[model samples]
Target: MQSGLTRDRLIAILMLLPSIILVAIFVYGFIAWTGYTSLTDSNALQQLSGLPAQFIGLKNYNDLFTGGLNLRFRIDMVNTVFFTVMFILVCLAVGMGLAILLDQKIKGEAIFRTIFLFPMALSFVVTGVVWKWLFNPTSGFNVLPTILGLPAGQFRWFISEERWWPFAWQDVPLILSILFLGIAIFAALWYWSKRRSQTAALLAALALLLLAWITFGNPRSLSGLNPERPEAHGFNVALIAIVIAAGWQMSGYTMAMYLAGLRGISEELREAARVDGCNELGVYRHVVFPLLAPITLSAMIILGHISLKIFDLVYTMGGGDNLYIDMPGINMFFTTFRSNQFGQGAAIAMLMLIMVAIVIVPYLASQLRSETKL
Candidate 1:
């Protein structure tokens, strides 16, 4: 019996060896090769004529981040930040709202859930095509007002050059200061609500305030002596149409995740809260929502990564021409395939990988630790 078992295990290992080797070669090997390529000078298509790749460590990265070659990278980075933030937040809000509604045992729950989730069944290309028509400034959904006997709406969707709420990239210090102050205020409120020591809360708030003050005490200090005074382009309102389309497609996935989480929660716990004088809203706010923190984090990470690496939707809907809708993925494609800048494109890919790793690695580590504890 022992000999037979050993032979079976060996056979299993041999059967899996091909898959393991393929994965190592195709996945990890390619990743290593890409990293090496990013550090080389392989830009022009002529360089691909069997010539050896020349080593040029870190130049591509530097050029991408700060070089005066083009504003494409910087602008794409800003647009990516705005798109990811808005996409994740809106998806979470809409998903959670839908999940909560479904959890209440509403009428036609099955039909409603199906309707919400149906969008996820469609491909990104299809979603983009549908939205492209809907956003056509002249002939598509924009003409509905005229059809309804109202004046035609003149809002330009993806082709608009107008921007609002603009602020220079050099003003990041001031932005961070304002954000830190707001966080400090929230931290103080949270501590007070939790009945933590007033002294501790006050000290925390004071420290944050001091940091903010140091960062942005003077506009001149924050802006620096030779800051690049580039034209500010605030959050593109054109992205609103894109966001709505993406959110409509993704919110259903989030809702399904959240709905599963809500269902897994024991009804007894909810009833117990009610028995303890908690209203529906209070129960959700103080108990149910807090309990779904893990689900929320999971959904956020998933949606955030999707938004970061998004290509098809933007490519199909905006055709990568709108500066407001440009992302690293589309930019990398254009740089490498269209413009034949292989090194810079590889660098962009590596940067995007790093960004995704930053968001995902911690959550994965935490999950492993929890599983180990279990």
Candidate 2:
């Protein structure tokens, strides 16, 4: 019996070995190769000749953040920050609303769910194309005003270059450090309230380490390593159009998550809340939202990574060359493929990976911890 069990386990391991090997090589191996390339001064000839590129340790990343010729990358970073925040907030709000409405056992519930979820099935490229038409400066919605006997609307959509709350590039490190400090302090307080001193202490330590790194270490040189000028960076109004498009496509996914979370909550718990003198709004505020915290965290992490790595959607909507709303992904593509600046492109890719990992790794660790407890 023991030999039979051992043989079964051995066969299972053998069956999984091919997939593990493939993932290790194609996924992680390529990631390492990209990291190595990013540290080099590779160009088109080297790529074509299959020759190793010269290493220039951190130059590509430094140039991207604080160098003279990389203003576009700075703009992309600022835009990413605002876009990620807005996209996640919008998706959560819209998804929660839709989930709540549908949870009331509305008529044609399945049809409404299918309709809402249909966009998630479509590729972002398709969604972007559709939204681009809808957002065309002089054509789509602009003409609707004229049809309504009003003058044609003059909104520039993605072409608008107007910035809100612009700031000097030099202050980036201080700004980010402050933000990190705020979050860390908040988490420490929350954990302390829960009497989780070890977790709270760990968060405080990590936060301090990050603050030190941003200030003194400056790995990506966020302190303006070699700025041409401390160029103004801020929230681009043009991102509103893209945000709307993205929110439309991705909110359905959040809705599904929220809807599942809502259903998992017992009806009895809600009844108990009512018996305790909680109204509908109070029930949701005090009970439902709190219970859905895990879902919210998961959604934010997932959406945050997606927003950080967004490529096809931005490319399809604004065109990579659109200075007003160019994203890191689009810029990376243009740099690598269009201009054959492989090293710089790889640097952008690595930065993006780092950002996504910052958002995802904590959530993953929490999940693993929960599973171990279970």
Candidate 3:
């Protein structure tokens, strides 16, 4: 009987070997190849800046952590972390909040839900294209100030360098004047936020803020002030755009997941929480959230992985020029193709794979452990 069972297990493994091989080839194998490439200065893959490639083990990685010409690799590593954290938090907050709100027996909830979720069906490439048009400095909400009889060329939005961050509470006056001067900014925000969709709210808020900053905040606009530092360029704006667009798209799906998880929860638990002196917020915070931890963890892993591997949206949205791809991940693959440094490109791909793994594996293990205990 033992021998027969062993034979059966081997047969099952053999049956599954094809799929396993497929995954290895497409996913794990590709990553391994890329890792090998990163260790080499393989100029045969692609060439840029006339830098000939040779076997430079860990040199590229060192430069990546240190600095390169554009300082892009290092910047991008930081951006990746920042982007991942922000994306996960924003998507969870917006999605989970909307899920709760829409689940509250509201009328026309399905229609509203569908409207919010429709963006998920789109490819990242499509999302980027649409956002590019919407974010176009001259033609988009950036120009709304001028169109509404505000000063001509008053708003710089994404283009101006003089106005960036508000350092403190006192500097907030600058942020607010820039906010109020842009015509219809508040109106647009109100319209978007009145609905339950977080994407609409976020977009509207950004539009207003960017409008205000460009119109009132920029020193260049206030006077003929030349930039002391060079204007911020590269794919930073494009990355920002991609994050916003992708976050908007993903939020709806997250909302759906949370909604399902909420429904799965027993009504008695909520009532019990109330009897225990918990209000609605308290019940959600203390009871619902704890019960929903598994689902939330699952959702977080998905979003985290998605954020790490988010290439198509970043690639297609904007900043495709050689000057722009200089920003790291967006260009890393292109660099391999252009310079024929397939190995280096592969290495970048592998690095991204590692990042995704780092985020997901431990979370999944914990989730499984929790489920087993339950």
Top candidate when judged by lDDT against the true structure: 2
Count of residue pairs whose backbone atoms collide, per candidate = 0, 0, 12
Tell me the tens digit of each residue's lDDT in model 3 across 1-374: 36655877999999999999999899878667677778887776236566665677876665454333524554465456556777888889899999899879799998999988999999888887787666666676666677778854443332333322313222334445664545345655666667745755665677767765665665343322223433232223334545677788899988999899888888899999999999999999998888878777888899988877777776665443523322356757665767565655666666777788898889878878989999
Which regions of candidate 1 deviate over 4 angstroms? 1-15, 46-50, 173-228
Ranking by TM-score: 2, 1, 3
Please report the TM-score between candidate 1 and the true structure: 0.86
Residue 91's lDDT within candidate 2 is: 99
Estimate the TM-score of every prediction: 0.86, 0.90, 0.70
lDDT of each: 0.85, 0.90, 0.67
- Considering every candidate listed, which one attains the maximal TM-score? 2
Q: Tell me which residue pairs clash in candidate 1.
A: none
Instruction: Please state the error at residue 334 of candidate 3 in Å.
Output: 2.4
Q: Give me the overall lDDT of model 3.
A: 0.67
Task: Flag regions of model 2 displaced more than 4 Å.
Answer: 1-5, 46-52, 195-222, 225-228
Model 3 earns a TM-score of 0.70
Backbone clash total, candidate 3: 12
Query: Residue by residue across 1-374, what tens digits does model 2's lDDT show?
Result: 36555877999999999999999999999999999999999999887899878999999998997677898998898889899999999999999999999999999999999999999999999999999998998799878988879999999998898888988787787787778888998999899999999999999998888777766774435466545455677888999998999999999999999999999999999999999999999999989999999899999999999999998888888757787778898889989998899999999999999999999999899899999999
